[model samples]
Target: MRRSGPVRALLAASAAAAVSAGLVVAGGGAAQAAPAFRAPMPAHVVAPYYETYAGGSPAALAAQSHNTYLTLAFLQTPAAGSCTATWNGDATTPVSKSVYGKDIAALQARGGNAIPSFGGYAADTTGTDIADSCTDVSSIASVYEGLVTTYGVTRIDLDVEADSLSNTAGIDRRNKAVAQVESWAHRTHRNVQFSYTLPSTTTGLGATGVALLQNAVANHARVDVVNIMTFDYYDGASHEMATDTETAAAGLINQLAALYPSEKPSHLWSRVGVTDMPGIDDFGPAETFTTADAATVEHWAAAKGINTLSFWALQRDNGSCVGTAGAGACSGVAQSDWYFSHTFEAFTHSKWTWGKGRSPWSEPKPAPRQAERGSRM
Candidate 1:
């Protein structure tokens, strides 16, 4: 669904404010202006998953100005000296020696944050299945504490999406898992951030899904964000296929906002949101990076008062666009292109400004072309 006219007007106004002070590139030759003050979204954090092999590389992490990288979880047995499985089925090793140190150091050196995640999509290859046994709390806590002390990471994301949420036992187990983690984070003197990645609301997963998540967030005081997995809705239904993914995302945000108020005396509304890995399939038959679609999603988020805006990934759609025909340089590099273009365009064309009184990263303004020598003389 397209953004309502009023919402579009708001976006336009925001863009204009951002541009006047040179928060974004106005054109190729325009001179850079002094920075302006703009309030940033309180929790505008991006959580890119850094593969273990991809660890120790600051180049990619530095380019994005990302706030956090939710490193893939470590699965290990409960035994004291048991080996741990990294996300990619790589050889098991101690958290201190291998992945944790390497990943955190690289990201931190680049001024980015890293958080260790516990559970992922894969089944329990790690002999100790925390999901199966709530009693493994101490072992889970031990790993979490060790990572924090070793890597100096303050955040921890728990990706708890499992195969079933239909039964009470399942939901209870999920709740306990969160409680255990929060308890450990408190004891460690580390301000840990907790979150869950669940399917979007459209799926027939029902209130059980919502209940389990809401309970987890409420009971576990330290939980900070709940990232809704809003993409991959390929259910063979026309409505599901044809629905404007952004609008659907907006509605979900609104629902969560209402459920968790910003002014609540206790928590930060644990900002409700949706994330998608933008791709040809995301656009369906249109097969393109729909600027209008992206705008609509942003507008919906702003209008509904959602606290954060995140995508499933950054690398996927950085600088590419697909059209009715197929994918190519229909525009530019998908993910990177959109990030730079939209980020600048939003400043030039909308109201949001950079948080640090400067653009996240600066590009040099083009030099003026030389005047025609003969004609001028």
Candidate 2:
């Protein structure tokens, strides 16, 4: 997405604020004191999947232990002629089918929460309308309630994202759909967590998209979490990662926090999202390093009172680390080496030390020797 117009304005304002404070590069993963405004509890990283496990069982376990949250569900439609009936194409029969039920049972068994998300990035006007209908609401809710009751689920993640925000009818349908889902969430008495995969840059979604999210958050108090898609900023085209990417991502989160401070449960619930790719073919040649870079970004967000860190996929980041020696034989190949080698380091280094005397968003400046490399968005 092009970073211009309103987004450019927001970026400029954020850049000015950071420049006034004298931007400093920091090194080391030492726990830093929290600023006055401490973020809420730390949220976990989620992995995306259709039906099969991309990262396999080991990856799932690693993710569960590394973070407190897990999402093991997908987008699907309610079964035909059945109220509150939902089923996925990948799984045979409805959610009650042995295979589907087994999947939900396994996720719950692992101490991870499983929720069947509804809509995604693609435009689904008909689906949105069905979701908006009163009849559909009860049906979908019934299905969700059944899943919760059967699988012992405690939370639901609603993945609602649509393409056309400019049209009046489209906006109305989107709002109605959200309202219906929110209502169902309340009726079920389960923690309904609303998440989205937004563009990493402020301009990534264009003016219409930004307005849609802003309006929704402002009006819908029940919407819990907004998980922005923070990766894919450069698409491997630019050798120099723009300071704008960092500024824009942080600025967008700050803007939302300021807008909905009272509505949000805690500071930690406020998230400046990003995606991690173990290795992407498009991001030029992969440069391996210590877990220092990932830790730096986490620390930056922590200091700013943003606690949620989301990776795009579990399978992608699971790779071998080539270190500073540059690309080796498996330079661009997706190996489990990097993820295995750095998972421990990344998780350990992400710890934030908040105290009574420090600012909510404060972190030790990076040591002079540390260099900022191209981010793995």
Strongest candidate by TM-score: 1
lDDT of each: 0.41, 0.38
lDDT of 2 by residue, 198-241 (tens): 45453344455467666665556344445554434444344222
What is the alpha-carbon lDDT of model 2 when measured against the actual structure?
Answer: 0.38
RMSD, model 2, all Cα superposed? 16.3
Q: lDDT score, residue 250, model 2?
A: 57
The clash count of every prediction, one per candidate, is 18, 25
How does candidate 1 fare on TM-score? 0.59
Tens digit per residue, CA lDDT, model 1, 1-377: 00001111112232343334223212222332211111222344445443333222322332333333334443433442333323333444455434345434544544444556555444232323344333443444555555555555655555445443433453455466456655644443334455555566453223655676666656554345555655445554443321444545555555555546553421232254445444444435433334445665555544433333454333333443334222221222234443522432232222333343222211122133332121100
The superposed Cα distance between candidate 1 and the true structure at residue 171, in angstroms, equals 5.0
Error of 2 at 358 (Å): 22
By summed lDDT, which 10 consecutive residues of candidate 2 come out lowest? 1-10
Provide the TM-score for each candidate, comma-separated: 0.59, 0.57
Number of the top lDDT candidate: 1
